[model samples]
Target: MQGVTVVDHPLVQHKLTIMRSKDTSTASFRRLLREISLLLCYEVTRNLELTSKVIQTPMQEMEAPTLEGKKLVFASVLRAGNGLLDGMLDLVPAARVAHVGLYRDHDTLEAVEYFFKAPSDLENRLVIVVDPMLATANSAVAAVEKLKSRGATNLRFVCLLAAPEGVERFTKAHPDVPVFTASIDERLNEQGYIVPGLGDAGDRMYGTK
Candidate 1:
């Protein structure tokens, strides 16, 4: 609640509702995630700093506002995060891309990283880490930690859905990083799944389940 910002735009809400439905087809759900992610990108990047640069617009040379500093980085938390990645890239086409592969260790309920690759200039740019679900916060927290280990300082987290428990834990672990989500669901179920969440995002999107 403290650092979390919900993107409650009408289009986002509409798309999310479609995604949450059990009757939705895999192709339809994937399409909706891509569409909703574009809206979330708008909210998450709303405050990016702008600078003026002289440019000729047709007849006159005038200053034009453009994003300042290095290009942003979209660090997707693998599999499901990739669903948001395509849409986010649609908005910031010049932004760099990174992937962090992590999975929850069922017994220990801890995040285990299998792969990580990022741009070399992560320290100089804003990094927005994305995942579709933040149920237990294990994977999200670990992914952010791995990014920081690679010199990513200016970071933010984005998700399609999040549980209150996950949000609290994520904010407490990294208060400096802000979070953006389309919705905050009631709570997580006993199996560490977000209640009423769009099922396993990866499975649903790719039809694995």
Candidate 2:
């Protein structure tokens, strides 16, 4: 997390600009999030190990590369994380999925986990915990802790956006997990929302607000 992967690629930045505007429609925002998620997924999975194999191409036989193992798991940090899931799944369609839900205590800013589900053998799998935003690191950090306690070892975190404070807190808490985010926004507000964030991800994505 110290070297949190922040994607500043032009396309991602452009779509993020669209997301930030107050007038962006739900359909447009959803499409943009999916498109950007696909791009971001490409970056996040770049280092996955590959094994060589003989295969038949359209023209002729050739050596091909495939994933080294079948130990991948995709864990979402709840409602908003669902938006990022489809895109990541497009890249890793076969990965097993898990979900964790955490809500904040308005006064204390602490995370309260109300729901959690995951693969039983999490310790041996390559877990990718994804969420749309990393704001204050409360839910983010808590989710990782829960995953670890449940036996997740090889873990990677993916997000659409992040705040410096959140990233710092997360890395300090779990240095082993590398983080991937499309953009790192400015500081967090008193309520822990990333400044200039795309409002509430869950609210915006589902038209709850």
Q: Which candidate tops lDDT?
A: 1
Q: Model 1 Cα displacement at 167 (Å)?
A: 0.5
lDDT of each: 0.94, 0.88
Alpha-carbon TM-score of each model against the true structure: 0.98, 0.94
| Deviating ranges (above 4 Å) for candidate 1 | none
Which residue runs of candidate 2 sit more than 4 Å off their true CA positions?
none
lDDT of 2 at 191: 80
Extract clashing residue pairs from model 2.
123-151
For candidate 1, write residues 85-178 as lDDT tens digits: 9999999899999999998887877888999999997999999999999999999999999999999999999999999999999999999999
Residue 134 miss distance in model 2 (angstroms): 0.9
